[model samples]
Target: MLLQSHLRSVNPDATTIENAAFVAYRKDATNPDHFIPVVPSESIAEAPYILHLLPALPPAWPNGHIEGLRARGGCEVDVTWRNGALASANVRAPHGGSLRLYADGSLSKTIRLGAGETIAWPLP
Candidate 1:
């Protein structure tokens, strides 16, 4: 329910809007039922969004408990729209990275590279 709460906090309109979809997935194969939301594509389209990572605890197995283990990390997505297009960036913490987009109404191609990265593609 943390994800639901988080989404509510980030986008209040989401609660009132219909046709919004939320999905979850488990990162570890051993715990298939342990699902969590990974990417919120639709919600991300909403400007000025926030993403939170919840705390983690090691799973109990064979009647044993373990401590000192913590969840990987978390991120907060901040989006802004300008001139009839959506522009946003993701700020990742504990490990830092960012994703930005420059979109137009029709079709557009943009390549982003960071620190010794190379990308090749075709434009249509």
Candidate 2:
């Protein structure tokens, strides 16, 4: 399964994502030691899965930036960014499923996806 790299951008361009399968990042974008890529264990069968990579571990910080991520499925999500910082996301899944949203500071949320439904998720 491959995910589009442009999903990482606050303002995605027309460039298409190709030949990539993993979305990678660091808990702290500035900390090279914490870099990790998010790889889904199973092929996405329901919602189009996309990730919003926050700028910092707490994510509530006033500053941060975007990181690259990759995944599969055919759901389009609109990510909301505030002043170059991560804020929230609107997600939709075509077949319905579940996702565990995670943050660097042990913060996580389990979202239930309904078929052809859109869900909005806010970040801390």
Once superposed on the true structure, which residue ranges of model 1 sit more than 4 Å away at CA?
Answer: 1-73, 95-124
Task: Mark the 10 consecutive residues where model 2 has the least summed lDDT.
Answer: 10-19
lDDT of 2: 0.42
- TM-score list, all predictions: 0.19, 0.40
lDDT of each: 0.28, 0.42
Residue lDDT tens for model 1, 19-111: 222334445567776665576566554323222212121233112222222222233323333332333322233333222211232211222
| Top of the candidates by TM-score | 2
Cα lDDT tens digits, model 2, 1-124, are 1122223221122122221213454365778667666654454233223243442445354543332232234455555466544466555667765543322222234456689877655533
Q: Tell me, by lDDT, which candidate is best.
A: 2
